[model samples]
Target: MPSMTEPKLISGNANPTLARSIARRMTMHRGINTNLVDARVERFNDQEIFVEVYENVRGEDMFVIQPTSNPANDNLMELLIMADALRRSSAARVTAVIPYFGYARQDRRTKARTPITAKLVANMMVEAGIERVLTLDLHAAQIQGFFDIPVDNLYASPVFALDIRHAFAGRLDEVMVVSPDVGGVARARDLAQRIGVPLSIVDKRREKPGEIAEMTVIGDVTDKVCIIVDDICDTAGTLCKAAETLMNAGAKEVHSYITHGVLSGPAVGRITNSVMKSLVISDSIEPTAAVRDAPNIRIVPTAPMFAQAILNIWNGTSVSSLFDAETLGPIYEGMYSSQ
Candidate 1:
């Protein structure tokens, strides 16, 4: 960096493995002796969170990595407190790297007397000293408008497209991408177009919470290799059901590529026993023991992508370039260069 102050990375307790992987990729990309900022985010006896940075960050550009996943409230608190700490320590800048942005689903009000928690979170981050936000695959794109600060939302389509190409190389002609519901048609269409495959949608309807969801296929999946695309896979109920619907409609096989694997409750069990061939999720959220042990579950590393984004942001380069397919190829390929 041209500046005398070094760029610093600080991570919270959420998804430490992903934070480390991103740090490693940053090392490879920058070719400098770089590491995460020495910090501790622990809980007190009453479960109160505490964050302390063990270094001088005066005038340094600070990047805080914390994904508000399973324990959304705790992780969110840690992020806010860390940002406050960095600002108080005289850090020149503080950018929030939230791989899996929690409360994204609550972007809109579904019923009366409901709050848009996504907007509230954005307000809280800004008030807590966050200058910028770097997130991946938000549930709703419009969440960006909620933030008054600059928000760079990254997509995982290119990474997933590369894996889909490599995994279904031999049967490219038979592959077709399926969106689990009408709400995901755009995401599914993007992936389908990237790989030059057909597109389908599952019309999902639910009467209310805790009720069984009904799914109906929109396009022909007969004798086709179905690949379901979605942003978050929470319980895997809808995903499993979508796969079953495709199979019942005469699909040759079924697979899924989800960005955030918020695999809570009986998610692992459902995917394991479902008709889907495999479930591919990004490392935005840390995997649980059951998730790792599941035979049908696979994780795709997003460190290289996040790492490149971080570098571009630090260097004042074009982060949007990474979204371009032609530009993304080299970075994704570069990931294997180190391995």
Candidate 2:
């Protein structure tokens, strides 16, 4: 752990709003004494990313906040080049704080000839002079092993649980937490336990990429408020299909709560036409304008938990409590005073 004064937060063009939100949660103000050096991220005729940090950062413990969201290559290269520049400037330490890690879905190889892009990204960060990393709700937790340095994987379950608690309040019992697939059962289970509700699973089969076949739902959801929980909502196909299945099976109402909202393709339109009553997602990734203006979609901030985690890391405090099942709410006081 590093000292409070040693850490300095920086930002890139990717999701500046989330970075600002995290900063506000950290300092309890709109802006901190941090610097976002003006860098014109451009490419040559050969299509190569170029970055030049305008401000000096000699011997400072720097953290570059950038989510590898849309325009993945551009944002990713920006983070990499920023780290390299900071390294060249003699920074004491560099930590890449990526709220939304892109290409995390390719953590493993399912075919004979395939690239483990997630591990490749980890290698890229390490080679770019990033000594440590901070990320949230990785598609696969084992991806942490891909990195040689310290990789802190934060959980968004606590944040989502609090939101669900407040949003439904007395109607929580009627809610049934639904995991869209078997891979997400653990995540949904955690949320169900926190909100004290029964759990259900959508046993679906992926016939091909970007498509899903909703076979049958396990457990009871009839006449119950259904809540689908997952780490990411990319394309929103599985979620929409699952909601339709739940609705067709006599579910009273259907909703969704996902950590990352990667609303690509026709996801927005699909979600609009789906049987889901509402879709709740966190601001880990920047949503498109259509996603932002969607009537049924809402974004909850993950800034408070992240800001507290940063403070704890700075103060050399225990972050284990953040994952404790019993304490599923953001830690107040201590480092979370502003929250």
Candidate 3:
């Protein structure tokens, strides 16, 4: 018999490894009887998704862990259907835990007649009975406004900062954090501030999708190890181009810390051939085989942080405090290094 005080964790197929990790961490950290609710999520012959919850969730707090990653539409529909199933099954509440919120890049309209798909997705979730959202490093922070329900946007900076600290190891001055674009300056600056390093920005022009019109380094990177920070690395065109630009401007080496590794298409090949020394990404999205096989790519698990946040939410604690870089307190002490 499951206790009513414990939250039931459910997962869709989007990123099963991360979901299971979060459940395990919840058990280990909270000392609560955490259970991963078994559910059947499959496809019908017509390519429609079917979801059925196998356990009773009536009046129990329920959480659905599903990242809208590759096959974005299908995965998204699965989340919606699962949320709907939980709501209809009389679950007290359904909090959608989407580590990598897909379509977040389209948070706003870049051109005339364009759609704000991020808002649309938010509305869809709310309509599907999602009472809350837990996501990591949204491409645009303002996307939180799209949801009327509480949305907790988590960061992977602390995890990256720990690894960078170990990698630099008392030579942090030689490192310069570089934002791949002007928009990411804040994100890069946060990491730089945490590591006590200088910050730079990459000024780039994009004439079309998956293409870089021009790229120029905006700050001094001469002989400095540059680390480019961004939220996603979809095709790796911008990252590869920015790395080349940094090297041309006299950077000693270039690395990247991206939150979501949506490395679709030739992203792995591009990063492998680029001037970048390494590309570190959080396992927000389940990595594809190419991402796993790439020589320069490294993955850091985000489940521990997420598990803590879930516990905090259930306990009515402050979730934003988790973003404090200093408070993370050596959780990765000897376990992480810049590979």
Candidate 4:
């Protein structure tokens, strides 16, 4: 429903496949014919970023698709420069369609003398002439408040719900939704409510930012099919530990559904050796070679939901219906509710 008169699509080097898929769904024309200029960024001898945009976007409502995933700093700078360039070209509005918004985990100051990098990223977007933001499942939902412009924080749980329902049709009564850590209890609870299952939480302690100390599960997972729901899975420590804990607690099967797969360091190997049956992740962050090669790692597409959201936003309609449990079709409601 984007205004056919002045809409334009642009993308950076990051996740061009997703951008192209979104463009295809929007135009129904096998992707829009927008140019993707090579942002030849380099260090200025002093290790500073230099960016340049090669396309003209005058009077257009431009949507720049860029995921700040791996090499996040470079991708973030590229997106900022694209926004700035579009604004300079007299674009009507610039939308930063970042599937993965980096620095979101640092939304607040958990310790003394730590900078709130998420707020800093928001400020940079504002300064770079970004009129709006479209991101999927930020680590901290509060990060949406950092932006001055309207931000759409999309959820991947609904999509996951559909797949889960289809994959585990008659086994709903044996399913249990779990949070990998205590802090993610709210997210898991929301998913469990929508899926109509019992909710459980993994009581975990983090000794360091990228380290997991101990994991103790709170709810009864005995002989139950467990599904761990989390916003992001980086390093895979927390997820692996939680899976191990659930198995130790007598879980019959363990599956993980993470929004962003930031699989870093030994994540793939850890998941390979862990007790999790499958690790389902969204296409918000581009999959790595290791993730693609892992037999247990499965990917669910978010393009349909994102495309529908773009349609809703363009037509100035309500997007709240997307999160409603009833509207997600009867197959999911019956399957998940019984579980």
Segments of candidate 2 deviating more than 4 angstroms = 1-4, 29-47, 324-339
Give each prediction's root-mean-square deviation over alpha carbons. Answer: 1.9, 3.1, 2.4, 3.7
Whichever of 1 and 2 has more TM-score, that candidate is 1
TM-score of 3: 0.95
Taking all chains together, each candidate's TM-score versus the true structure is: 0.97, 0.91, 0.95, 0.89
The 10-residue segment with the lowest total lDDT in model 2: 330-339
lDDT of 2 by residue, 83-189 (tens): 99889989888989999999999999999899999999999999999998889999999999999998888888877777777778788879999998888999999
Residue 237: error of model 2 in Å? Answer: 1.3
Question: lDDT score, residue 156, model 1?
Answer: 91
Off by over 4 Å in 3: 1-4, 330-339
Please report, in order, the local distance difference test score of every candidate based on alpha carbons. Answer: 0.91, 0.83, 0.89, 0.81
Q: What residue runs in model 4 are displaced by over 4 Å at the alpha carbon?
A: 1-4, 29-55, 325-339
Looking at candidate 3, what is the lDDT of residue 167?
A: 73
Candidate 1 all-Cα RMSD: 1.9
Better of 2 and 3 by TM-score: 3
lDDT of 2 at 12: 80
| Collision pairs in model 1 | none
**Runs of candidate 1 exceeding 4 Å displacement:** 1-4, 334-339
Cα lDDT tens digits for candidate 3, 210-326: 678999889889999999999998889888989999999999999999999998888899999999899999999999888899898999988888888887877778888888756
